[model samples]
Every structure is written in structure tokens, then in C-alpha cells.
Target: MDILKSLGHPEELINLFKFKIGGCRTIMPKLDYESMSESLRTCYQYLNQTSRSFAAVIQALDGELRHAVCIFYLVLRALDTVEDDMSIPLDRKVPMLNDFHTYLYQDEWCFTESQEKDRKVLEDFPTISLEFRNLAREYRDVISDICHRMGVGMAEFLEKKVGSMKEWDQYCHYVAGLVGIGLSQLFSASQLEDPEVGQDTALANSMGLFLQKTNIIRDYLEDTQQGRAFWPKEAWSQFAGRLEDLAHPDKLELALSCLNLLVTDALRHVPDVIAYLSRLQNQSVFNFCAIPQVMAIATLSSCYNNPMVFQGVVKIRKGQAVTLMMEATNMRAVHTIISQYSQEILQKVSVSDPSREKTLHTLALIREKSTLSQSSLQSRTHHLSPMYLSAAMLLAALSWQYLNTTAVQTQGTGDMQG
Candidate 1:
């Protein structure tokens, strides 16, 4: 069904087929689970459980850096779970957020009382904190520092709503930008990348901001429906009476205007993203960083000037995501992906839209930074005919079915032998 939805995107369809049949190992290699320590293995389990989008890239990270990042992610995931659970009293939540860093040093500090779905991390904090303590001092220092700052930042925001653009950036910086900086520091600490990758805070912050903003833009309905709001009041108030009012059927024009304005704000970070990716030296680290940024741009392209954002979810197709995962391994491929999506957004720009000029200007800067030659800009699927795409999708579906049946039969045979 997903393949059928992506019939117009033949390259993505092919990439999707390749990914399903184990070609993804070439792009995203997994760590050996059985060889891991009990605590480390548990951390990976929580990573997979908490983040569908990030677990693969986190696993694909090279060497000890992979373990460090896995723990870092789990720590933040636990922190975010605490912040996100509205049922937690403000007094308890505020202190926990402020002192989340200190909890890393405690040997038995698990909190099983939380009601969030990913609360297992909090429920089993001792295991995670034990692993955190086992990390090398440099890696531990970076993770703990980011956790402390991010905790403090999360606490501060709990008392208020996002009122201004600057406040929005501050909030994203605390939650996400700090993750980028910490990961860069981990990469450098592992001797896989240069010190400047961690030291250049501005670029790292921008890397985080780009992904965070894209998520905030795309999740408008889900966030608002959940009684959470991340969009700045300063921007949304310009379009309607209240932020929630943008979702009303009668206010779609205003809703679209507000969405475009936020999308433009997100685009302003692309130049910084390009610069940040350019500085990456390790192939694994680059893939880890680049794939998400490209996916963010592709998502923004889908959401730009589109009303689906207000009505429901807006996500890039799974095939498109697989294509990005396969192709975004090198700087040149990343540039092409960013350039292609930038052009998609440009094509959707409406002249009467309030953010049209700013949108065009930001996109122009992105093109100038990320654009390659005209030949490189051509679509990968341009040569495929409708007949070929249809045949390919059919073959992929049949192949998947055969593989699944064979696996099930093999498992049955093993069970009978046992």
C-alpha cells in the first residue's frame, strides 16, 4: 500500500524495496546486541522503543561514540518524558528537571511512578545511570553537562507558553540544539571528528534548531490537540484569534498563512545546516547527522503552503524516507537532496502569501549554498516509465511476501526440531 502511494516516485520505490531486503545494512549497520553488557543492551532496547526515527542512526554511529550517544539519548528521553507528562505536579517536575543531571550520579534513583508511555526509562533509571557512570570521563562530562542545561531550560519553559520567536529558539536550543552540541562533542571525544565540530556551538545549535523547528511545524495538529503548543504566539496571533483557531475550517487561509510563516522561519536555518554538515569528517557521524537534516527538509517541502498540516498529519512517504536514508551518505548527495527539496518549496510559494518574500529569500540562500550543477539536479526517477514503475512495485510486493512466508516456515521448522 505504501509502495502504491509512492508510484510516482520510482526511485523511492526501488530504494524501499532494497531497504526491506537487508540493503539497509550497508547504510545503517547495527551493533551486536548479544556482545553488549547487560546495561548497555538494555539502553539500546530503550533507544529502539523510544525513537522510531533515531534508533537506526544512533546504532549506526561508529565505535564507543555509539554507546555514548545511546546513553545520552536515553537520558534525554527520560527527561523529556518527565517534562511531557502533564499529570506530574509542577513542583515535583520543576525540581526533577532542574536536578536531572545530578540523578545520573546516583546509583539507585529509578522513578517508577511516572505515567508516560516511555516511562520505562525512568522506571529503570539505575540501569541507565549505571551505564552513564561507566562511560569515559570526557563523554560522561559532555552528556551530563547537556543534561543539566537542558533540564534547567525545560523547567523554565514549564511556567509559560512560547510567546516570541526568540523564546521559541531558546526552547528548541535547550531541548535539541544541546543534543547536537553534545553529540558533536562525543564524536570529537572518540577521535572520529575534529575538535571544532564540538567547539563551533553556533553551527551545532542550528543543526538542532532545523530538525526541531521542522517537527514543531509538522506536528501542529497533534501538538495542539494534545493541549500543547510550541508555535510562537507572536507568529500564530497574526493569522487568527487564537492558535487553535487556525485549525477551524473557516480559517484555512489564515491557517495556511501562519503555517507558511513558520516554515519560512525553519528554512532560515538551512544555510547553517549545510555549513555544519560540511564540517563533518567521519562517514558514520556524517550519515548520522546528515540523514535527519535531509529528512527535515523533505518534510518541510511536504508541509510548505499545504493545508494538510492544519487538518491532519503531514509526513513524507516511507519510500521517500528510505530513499533519503540510502542516498544521504555523502556530502554531494546531501546537497542534491537539500537542493531538490528547496526547489519543491520554491515551486509552492504563493505570491499573495504574507511570508512569500522572506520564504523566497531564505530559499535563495539555501540554493546558493547547497545547489550543485544542473545535471546533478535532475530527478533520479525521470527515465522510468509508468509501465516500469508498476512492474517494479508488483515485483517488490511479491518478493516481500515470499521472504515473509519463508521466514515463518523456517521458524516453524526450528520450533519443531527444538
Candidate 2:
């Protein structure tokens, strides 16, 4: 693959981290795709754009781990896109989801005469749909094998009948929890990480839940508007008479209370993330862990105590994102980071209960896993090369400038290339 040179492997495991925070574009240069499967390339391009951080982590990996993980994300995202688009009706969408599942896990994924007849309808298409279809067809077995091993319990949960927050948590495991498991598998298989130091897959599930819960909570209004209801009936019953009624402004007070409970429960996992980050033996994994933790803290800070946080969608500003990243990078004490976020989330809690505060304590205990010795910390800092740091910062400034110029150029051409 011609791209292999650009996709050059990092000389040191720690350097792989540069990709984790910047997104996949950072490592696109290193991935040689000339000889790789077209379906894989199509997925890589999309995954790189959709999840820069995720892409970097993949870029840092080699061979089987990289291909398997990248394809998994590619297939999952394609299915997710099909599942989410409002344009497609459920009859078509459900089948597509089923097709995607079949393609992911089953060997009987070859397009039969029936499917070929269906394919003729898109004979004139010039896009990547065929590759997507092939991915759907050829990769299902591998996807199933991986997911089955990674998410057996979670799959059972997904199949279970839904009713409450308890159910929602179970659902999160099926959909998002397995992601943690799959990622851990890749990390473990690569042998680039310290299995002893990093947060195990089970603990990582809590971090995944925290993220997915935040997503569900933030998108409540938008998802409802789209005729989707991810929040379980059990949780909704605690507030409005019906799921649709939960959206009514008049019922917002009760809805907010329910949401607060969700967010509070979600925050309970931030410490686990801190613990996870601290245990990671690799800098790239650290970046992956840090960025999300920092983002979560910022999200909590922005939404806490503001009824408007749930009124619509909320996000952190670019400036705020930079600040959080810098803070996360500079702070050596994991507890300090968790403590700061704990205070932010605590301010948002509507009730003063010990159980809520106790969660923070649990997280605090997790943070202790990363504590560095005074001499070690001082020695590490003293070894830093100022010249290298300056060079890196200068490159970052130049990259931002180039991106702005390219954006302007692309906009003028009506051929936007990101």
C-alpha cells in the first residue's frame, strides 16, 4: 500500500498517543491504503472523520488488530447510520439493520439472486454504497464472532424486554458497553499496553455508560422530535404520564428531576475513567482516556444547574475544549482532576443525599491508582526537551492556519474536502 509510509508505525508506544486526541486525520498520512480492501478504505475515511480520536487509536495499532477494529467500527457506524436516518421507513430500516447484523456475523451473507435483483435498482449509483453492501455481506461473520465474544452479556440485555433505567443501563451495555470490551480486546491483543495497570474491560464499561447516558440525556428533545424514544418507559413513568408528555414544557420540572438522576448516576463513572486513564501504560490510550474525561467534565460543567441544558442540545466551545485539554494534560494528580469535576457535578444535583456524594468518593478512590511518586514526577518533568515542545506547538499553530485556508478554498470550489 502506497499509504503505508505515511501510516508508518510509531517508533515508541507512547508516541501513538498523538493520534488519540487529534482524531484520525492526524494519522491518515501513516496508513497505506493502496492495497487494502476498498470496503475497508471507505470505512476508514468515514470513521476517521466521524471519530478522529478513535481513528488515531486504530492507526497506532498494527495488522490484524487494526483491520479488525477498523472494520468493526465501519460496519457498526454504517448500520447505525441506516438505523438513524429519518428518510428510511422502519420496514426497510429494520431489514437493513438485520442485513447489517447478518453481514457482521453470519457466513451466509453472500448476495443471493434475490439481492442481485435488488442491487440492479442501484446500478447507476457512483458512490460507496456497493462497498458498504460488500462490507455488509463479507464482514458479518467476523463482526458476530468478535461481538459475540465481546458482548455476550450485553447481547442478552439487548434482547431483554425494556421497562426502566435499569433496562436502559442494560441496553447501554449491549450497544455501547461491548465497544469497551472490543477495544480492550484490541489493546490486550496488541500487547502494547500493561494489562495490570489499565482499567479492565468491565470497569471501562462504566466509562462507556457515562458517555452513552450523557448522549441520551442531551439528545432527549431531539430524539423525541425524531419519533424515537431511547429512554425506557420505567424512567419516563417516574415523570410524565407518557413518553411524549415528557417533552412538554409544563412537565419539564419533573423531567429535569429524572434527568438529574440520570446525570448523577452517569457522573458516578467519571472516576472510573480517571482510574482507567491512570492505569493505561500507553500515552495514546492516556490521550483517549483523558480527552473523554475532560470533555465529560466540560459537558457537566456546561449543563449543571442550567435548566436550559436539557432545553435543547448543548456542547462545549472550541476555546473551552482547548482549556480543558490543557488542564487535563498539565494536571499530574488524578484526584485533583476528579475532585474538580466532582464539585461541578455536585453543584448540579437537586437533592443533598449522601448516596450521591458517596459516588464521588468512590471515584476519588479510583483516582488514587495513578498517583506518581514525588521524585519520579520531578525527574520526568526535568527531562523534558523545551526545543521539542516548542516545535510541536509551532506545528499545531501552522496546522490550524492551513486548515482555515483549506476550508475557505473548499467552500469557494463547492468541493469541500475535510
C-alpha RMSD values across all candidates: 3.8, 9.2
Instruction: Give the 10-residue window scoring lowest on summed lDDT in candidate 2.
Output: 1-10
Encode model 2's per-residue lDDT on 260-311: one tens digit a residue: 6566667767656766665667555555456656676567656655566447
lDDT of 1: 0.89
All candidates: TM-score: 0.95, 0.65
Clashes of 1: 0
Q: 105 in model 2: Cα distance from truth in Å?
A: 7.6
Instruction: Give the C-alpha miss distance for residue 6 in model 2, angstroms.
Output: 34
- Misplaced by over 4 Å in model 1 are 379-390, 404-418
Model 2 lDDT, residue 355, Cα:
43
At residue 50, candidate 1 shows an lDDT of 82
